[model samples]
Target: MRDADPDLFVAVAHACLLGESPFWHPRERALYWCDIPGHRLQRFEPAGGALAHWDFDTDVASCAPQLDGRLLLAMRDGLWRFDPASGERRLAAKPPYDPAKERFNDGKCDPQGRFWVGTIYEPRDAAAATLHCLTREGLKRKAGGVTVANGLAWSPDGATMYWTDTKAHTIYAFDFEPHAGELSRQRVFAQFAPRAEGQPLDDYGGRPDGAAVDTEGCYWVAMFEGQRVLRLSPAGEVLREVLLPVRCATMPCFGGDDLKTLYITTAREKRPAAELAAQALAGCVLGLRVDVPGLPVNVVHV
Candidate 1:
C-alpha cells in the first residue's frame, strides 16, 4: 500500500511523447517500453543507469521478448521481428486493419506464447478497435467493440484474462484457456466513473490504460490522466491506490532481481505547456519500490 515517492528519479529519457506498454525482461534484468507517438523503443538498465533507444518508421506500441533474445514488436505497420543486437527487423504479419485509421496499441504475450495486441480507432467515433492474437496460424481477432484498446493482462493461474477500453472507462475479464490461447465468457471486471463534460483534471479519476498482474493474481493498472495506479483484487475491488507525480501515467511493469521494483511510464504528448512545465517528470519513466513481487514476463515462442 505504499505510494511512489514524489521525488522518484527518472529511469530513462525524460521526454517520451507518449510512453506505453512497459515490460520487465528477466533475462536482461532491464525494463523496456514504447514511446508510441515518438516512434521509438526504449531500454533502461536500472543497475547501471544505462539507456538505449531504437527509432522506428512507424508507431511501435508494444513489445514482448522471445526465447532467442529477439523482440516481437507490435507496430502500426505490422507485427515485426526485431533483433536488438544487430538492429535488423522484418515484418512478421501485416496489419489486420488499415494503418491510417487504426494502429496497434497496448499488447502483451500470453502465457502460452501468443502475442495478443489491441488497436486504437483514431477517429474517436465508434467502437472500431479490436484485440488480435498472433499465433502460428496467423493474426486472429479475439475481442472487439473497443475504441482505444489497452490494459491487457492475465491472472497468475492463467485461467482469466483482462482487457481495457480506455475510451469506455471499463476493464473486462474473460475465461481463458491458456494452453489453447483462447478467451471466452467476457464480462466487465471493473468500471470507473466517466469524466463529466467540462470536468477538471483534479476531478477525473482517469480511464484505464495498460496493466500487469502480480504473483498474487492481483491486477495493477495505470489510470491515465488520473495521477495514480490502482491495484485491484481478483474480484475487482480496488485494494490500493498508488499516487503518481505526473498526471498521465500510461503503464507499469515490475523489474529488478526480485520483481519488486515498479517502473512507470508517463506521457507528454499534446499536454499543455503550462502543465508540462509544472510537472518536471511529465514524460519520464519513473521507478518506485513496491512490496509485492510480480509475475515474470512471458516470452513469445517465435
Candidate 2:
C-alpha cells in the first residue's frame, strides 16, 4: 500500500559529494553520516537543528557509534576508531584488499554489537568486493561475489539478514543465526530490471543502495538514481514507494526521539550539470515523518 501523499523536508544543508551511511545515536540524540568522495563525516541534531562536520584524510565510507565515545569508521584504508571530540583516529583493522581497487561502503552494527561493513570495487569490472564483520576476535570476510556491496540491514528480530549488490540490481536475504553470527540460505529477496540500452533516464527505476529495516520488518531501501525509496514487505513485496527530490537516493535511516523520522542522504558528485541544476537538493539530507518507528541503533561492542 503506497501513500498517495508524499512530503519531505531538507533536514541538513551540507552539500556532500556522495552522502551515505546514515545512523541515529540514541544516547546523543543525533544523526551521523558520511560523504565518501568528500572525505567528510557529519552529525546533525534535529532537536537543536545544529549541524557539525569533520574532514578526513581518506574516504569515510560508513560509521557506527561505540559504547564509549569513539566511533567505528570504515574508510578506504581500513576500519578506524575515531574520537569525534579529539579528532584522533586509531587504526582498528587494515584493509584486506588493495585500497586502490576497493574500499568500504555501506555498513552498520548488528543487534548483537558486531560491526558489519561492505566494500565497493571502484573499477566496476567484476565482483571483487566483499562484506566483512568485526568482532572481539578481529575483522573477517563474511561474504563475496558482489561488485558494489550495499543495503546491509538485519530484520527486526535479527533472524534474517539483507544485502544488496547495486551493480546487479538485486537484494539478497539470508537466514541469520543471531547468536552465532552465521548466515545461511542466501536467496534473492528482490530483483529489478536494469536500464535498457539507450533508455531514457526517467524510465530507469534505478539500482538498490543503502537500506534499513523498520520495526515491522519491512526493508526500506534507497533507489540510487531512481529518485525514490522502496518499502518492501518481508516477502519482498513493494508496499510503498517514496519519491525523493533528488536524482541519487543513497541511503535511508530512521531517526528522531520516536524513531519515526526517515532521513535520506543523496548524491551529487559526477552528476550531469543539468540534473544537478534541476535537483538543487541533490547532495542534501532529507527527512520525512513516518508512522512506524525504527529499531534503536546497536552500538559497536569494542
Candidate 3:
C-alpha cells in the first residue's frame, strides 16, 4: 500500500477508542461513532473541532440517525431507540440470541428506512451470531448467519445488500428485495488476500471490519489486522489504499459539508506495549479528503 499524504489528513480527535461505526448526520453536520469496548457514543462536529460524548451502561456497536430526530442504536444485547437530545434510551426489542456473551456488531439502515444489524460473540465464538432486519412495523427477521459481521451497506439502487464477516475477510452480496426485506442469491463479492505477515488463519478467512460505499459504488473497507482501508470497485478490484498510522483502524465514513472528507475511526484493543508505542495515535480519529463525494446516508424511520 502507498503512504497517504499527511497534509490531506489531520488528526481530529485524540480519543482512545476501540472506534467503529462512523456515520455522518447531515442535518447536524456532525460525525457519530462508538468506542465499542469503551461503551460510549461520541459525536464530533468537525467544523470547529468540538466533540460531545455519551457513555452507555452497555457496549454500543453501532448507530443510525432517525428521521424523527432520534437515533437508532444497536447495543450489546438489543435494539434501542435513543433520544440523544433528551438523553432517553428505550428498548425497542431484543434479538433471540441476546443471551450472555453475545452482542451486536456492525450495522446500518437501508435506503427504504429499514434497519439491519448483526451480532457476534463477546469472546470470539466463530459462529455465534446472525443478521437481522428491523422493520417499521416492529418486526425483526433473521436475515442470515454471520461470524463477526462488521461492515453493512447497500447498493445505489437498493437492489443489493452488501455485508462483511470480519473474520472471513470477505464481502458478500445478496439479492435484496427492499420492499419485503428478503435476501437471496448469496455470492462472494470480494475477498482479502492474506498480508505478507504470517498471522494465524481462521475459519471464515479474512479480516474486513467497518466499511462505507461511495456514490460510484466503490467500497472503502477497513482491514483491521491489515492496517489499511482499501477502496475497491464494485467488481472487487483494488482501486486505492488509504494507510493508517495505526494497525487497528476500524471504520471509515464520508462527512464534511461537501461530503468529500473521509473520517476514519481506529482501535487500541489488544495491542502490545511496543506496538502501541510505535502507533501512539492508535485510537485517534483520522480524516482525509478524497476526490469524490459520498452518497447521502439514509436516516432511520422511527
Candidate 4:
C-alpha cells in the first residue's frame, strides 16, 4: 500500500525512442528490452553497469528467451532466432499479417513454452490486428479484432491469460488451457474511461500499454501518457498506483537477484518537445523495490 516515490531510482540513463518489452534473464543476471522505433535490442548488466545494444534493420517489437540461450525475436518482418554470443540471426517464421499495414507488437512466452505474440494495425482505423501462438506446430491465430495488441501476461496458477488493447482502453481475460495453448471465455477484465476530446494531457488517466504478473497473481501494468503504473488484483480492482517521472511509461518487469526490483521502460519518440524538456527521465529505464517478487520467465522451446 506504500507509494513508489521514495523507492524509485534510475536503473539506466539511456533515452530510448520507444522502449518496450522488458525481460529479466535470471540466469544471466541481466535485463533485456527493445527500442521499437529505434530498431534496437538492448542489454544492461546492473552489476557492472555495462550496456550493450543490437541494431536491427527492422523494428524489433518483442522477444522471449529460449532454452538454448538464444532469443526468439518478434520483429516487423517475422519471427527470428538471435544468438547473442555469436551475433547471428536466423528466420524462424514469416509474419502472418501484411508487412505493409500490420506488424508484430507486444508478446511473451506462455507457461507451456509457446511464444504468444500480437500485431498492431498501423492505420489505427479498425480492429484488424490478431494474436498468434508460436510453437513446434508453427504459428496459429489465437485471437483477433484487436487494434494495438499488448499487455500479454498469464496468471500465477497458469489458468488465465490477460491481454490489453491500448487504443480501446480495455484489458481482457481468458480461460487458458496451458497444455493445449488455447484461450477461451474471453471477457473484459478492466476498462478505463477514454480521454475526452479536446481535454488537456494532464487530465488523461491514460490507457493500458504493457504488463507483468507478480507472485501474488496481481497484474502490474503501465499506463502510457498517464505518468503512472498500476497493480490490479485478479478481479480487476486497482490495488496500488505508482507514479513515474515520465508520461509515457511503456512497460514494467521484475528483476534483480530476488526479483523484487521493478523496472519500467518509457518512450520519447514522437513526444512533444515541451513535454520532453520538462521530463528529463521521460525515456530512461526506471526502477524501484517492491514487496512481492515476480514469476520466473518461461523459456521458449524453439
Model 2 accuracy (lDDT, Cα): 0.91
lDDT, residue 212, model 3: 88
Cα misplacement distance, residue 42 of candidate 2 (Å):
0.3
| Residue 290, candidate 2: C-alpha displacement in angstroms | 0.7
Q: Model 4 misses residue 43 by how many Å?
A: 0.1
What is the TM-score (0 to 1) of candidate 4? 0.98
For TM-score, the strongest prediction is 4
Query: Which ranges in model 1 have alpha carbons more than 4 Å from their true place?
Result: 1-9
Model 1 lDDT per residue over 24-50, tens place: 998888888999989999998888988
TM-score: model 1 vs. ground truth: 0.97
lDDT of 3 by residue, 1-302 (tens): 33544644654546655988889899999989888889898898877788888898888899998889999889876889999888999888775574576788897988988888888765675666688878867747555566788778887778888888776677888898877788899999898765545654222123688888888888888888666788989888989877667777788889988889888898888877877887777888888888887777888874
Per residue, candidate 4 scores C-alpha lDDT tens digits across 113-145 of: 999999999999999999999989899999998
Top lDDT hit: 4
- C-alpha lDDT score of every prediction, in listed order: 0.90, 0.91, 0.80, 0.93
Q: For candidate 2, lDDT tens digit of each residue in 108-213?
A: 9998999999999999999998999998999989999999999999998899999999999999999999886999999999999998999887888999999988
Sliding window of 10 residues with minimal summed lDDT for model 3: 197-206
Pairs in steric clash, model 2: none
- Error at 153, model 3, angstroms: 0.5
Candidate 4: clashing residue pairs, number: 0
The candidate with the higher lDDT, 2 or 4, is 4
TM of each candidate vs. truth: 0.97, 0.97, 0.92, 0.98
Name the runs in model 2 displaced over 4 angstroms.
1-6
Worst 10-residue stretch by lDDT in candidate 4?
1-10
Global lDDT of model 3: 0.80
